[model samples]
Target: MSDTSLLSSLLNLITTATCNLQSELKGAGLPEPWIDNASLHPWDEETPSKKYWDARRTLISALGMMTAVVQNPREKIICDDLGYHHSAALNFIVNTHMADVLAAPNVDERIGLPVSEIARRTGTHPAKTERVLRFLCMYHTFQETSPGVFANNKVSECLKKGHPTAELPLMWADVGFRSATAFSATLRDPQTAHSMRIEDAPFGAVFGNHTSKSTSESESIPKSEPGTASPVRATIFEFLSRPESEVYRSAFAKTMVTLDIMNGALGYHDLPWDRWDKEGAVFVEAGASTGHLSNDVLSVVKHAKFINQDLPEVCLQGEKFFAENNAEAIRSGRVKFQPNDFFTEQPVKGAAIYILSNILHDWPDNEALKILKHIGDAMIPTSRLLVMEIVIVPSLSQSRSPPSAPVDQNPNDAPWPLPKDYGIVNRYPHHQSMEMINTFNGLDRTLDEYVALFQQSELELVEVHRIRKLVSIMEVKKKA
Candidate 1:
């Protein structure tokens, strides 16, 4: 396409998408969202219809495309290089609880709070806080009402401590930023490069406390075998358990909640709970942390018994959580907690449905295969395994292979000029894919990569259900 043609196409897409979005919002009686608006977007309260989602995808894609086309490549590269400052600023704001002070009961959203008062309330250096806030203001997050005063805008409201996504920034800014700084080192290191061990990931370079294994011990270990004693080391979770890491641990918990929120409630609602809620039905959740996912599933599958499995410590927490919040389910034996390692042999066999929600993506293919194999081994002819995680779309690929099992309508399809993966709409998943590499030497898999894993594990890819923008439910079973 010619330059003018490309620009015109992008402009047309933006205009059309924006119009559709406005129409959908008006039809739903939602206030049009603006960056300055302090109120939550309607989508936060209710899942958007397909029309709204499609419009959003197209709008974001076209805007990103237009920016890429217009911006000077050299400046764009420089901007990308300085992106760490974005993380640094976000870290400072979140750590100092500046958003909390800005959104305080006494604070005026319009007049705003002075930088000095914000620093005083949050125990931060006033000058440094102002500089950070100013940097963020350039990006239209928190707004500067006056020279030295800042206030909560719609974008910044999510940074408030009580907000659903508050911890998301800290998760990336503090932990993710530190880990990513060692990315090049991990790739360049002769010993760590080409290694799939979790301890060899970029995060290990930054915060590794694992004891070095001896040559004899390392040689005895089988390649990609997870439970073996070679390269004995603590994973990120173990590191978070330290007393000094309590703040990070708390942030990590809230970050998980943020992720669940981002995945949207519709993903859970669209599952075939009614079909799975039959008499004598069993649902096993592998690597289930504190039964949050089991709680979600149990809400719909009332008659189905649940076995939530994780490490022993996590199971203890799950027990307490269920006792306090779901006493009836616990008493009636509708929900049960079992301490089990997913890397080990399968314990709960012949389950009606086995769910590995957000689990396999934490490991590389070799490790992920082991996880699938265990579930495959335990599955009966009628069993269904749901691997629910981000199923990444290939940007350059043109193939739109039809799914095997039932599928809900998806709004991810992009037209000409837009990449097959929908460009900017897939940014989060790509970012997450990178995070998996930095944190666990893992990755978010493409659909093809997932199929390869399933085939190797003697499991068949039954179908895919794109439940949310970044999440999919891939149904699988033992190869027939």
Candidate 2:
């Protein structure tokens, strides 16, 4: 189809998807998302009907692709590729706590706050604050009620302190933005480009000072197998584990909590936790950070004894978290926090279920294979391993779209064909894979790669429970 025809078809798709999404929300009795007076809602809070959310996601994907399709070639190449400007603006807004300023109780939410007042409260120059806020407002992050005055929209409210996702902006603006600056350079450098070691990653190149002392010592740590060196180096976790890195570490932890709120809790929802409803059945959460996943499991799977394991510092934090949030579970001995390194042999043996949630993607194949092996060594005949992670799917490229066909030829299909990278199903996993690469020379794996890793540990892929978009619960068992 001609560019004009394609653009018209995309516009039609956007219109149709928007109408469907609105109808779904109305049917479900949920408020329509409005930029002017948006409210921040947690994922689990008054969860919308599945149909409504599915329509919402479809609408977003259609709108995004439509915008991409309509952009002129030069505009797409020049504007879409730019990032430094966005990073700088986001860094300014996050660092200055502009969202917090707008969310202040003293300020009238309806009237909003002027840039001068926000700048005064944040100790920033008014002009610079106005410029950045305006940029963000254009993208619907915040709302400009009138010229120079801004209010917190749903997106901006997420940046407020203590919100589940508040630290996300800060984490991305500080660590991710800085690391991304060196991404091209890291890829071009011969020594770093081909290396799977974390120290060779873009984050390591930019934030080298944060490297942990233990990482150097780990060079002497024996490899899991002979004739192969462990793909070990000072990873992002090591950097954050340092005493001086407490602030960044806290932000990172909160970021993980945000992810748990969004995707991790879904693990509890459509699974057969009832299978282990019998008393004394053990459930181990390996590499548990702050025990969020364990908490989710304990909330529903009452009969199981929970073991939340992580590194020394994370376990200490997890203990405090459980003490404060899940006091009864701790008091009753139903839940316990253990300091354990996953690289070492599993200390907890023969658990009914071992959950490795969002863990293996932090390492290369060699190290990931070793982690699986360690878990396998600890498993009994009936023990199961549940790996909760994204299974990256191969996406179709837009360049490979079928030859000029009439838009009406496929009435069964939407007026505009869904792009190869349509929806969060494809976008999120791909972005996360790139994030893994930037931070630790790791990657989100495809189903084939996961199956291969399972085989290397003498385990077989038993089942795959797709618990959420972009994430799946890959069940594995010892090979017969």
Which pairs of residues collide in candidate 2?
1-404
Across residues 351-410, which tens digit of lDDT does each residue of candidate 2 receive? 999989899999999999889999999999899999989877665444434346675344
Model 2 earns a TM-score of 0.87
What are the lDDT scores of the predictions, listed in order?
0.78, 0.74
RMSD (CA, angstroms), candidate 2:
6.2
The alpha-carbon deviation from the true structure for residue 183 of candidate 1, after best TM-score superposition, in angstroms, is 0.7
Tell me the tens digit of each residue's lDDT in model 1 across 144-235.
Answer: 98899888888888888877477766567766776787788777777777888888787766556533222212323212322223344556
Q: What is the C-alpha local distance difference test score of candidate 1?
A: 0.78
TM-score of 1: 0.87
Off by over 4 Å in 1: 1-4, 210-233, 319-333, 397-412
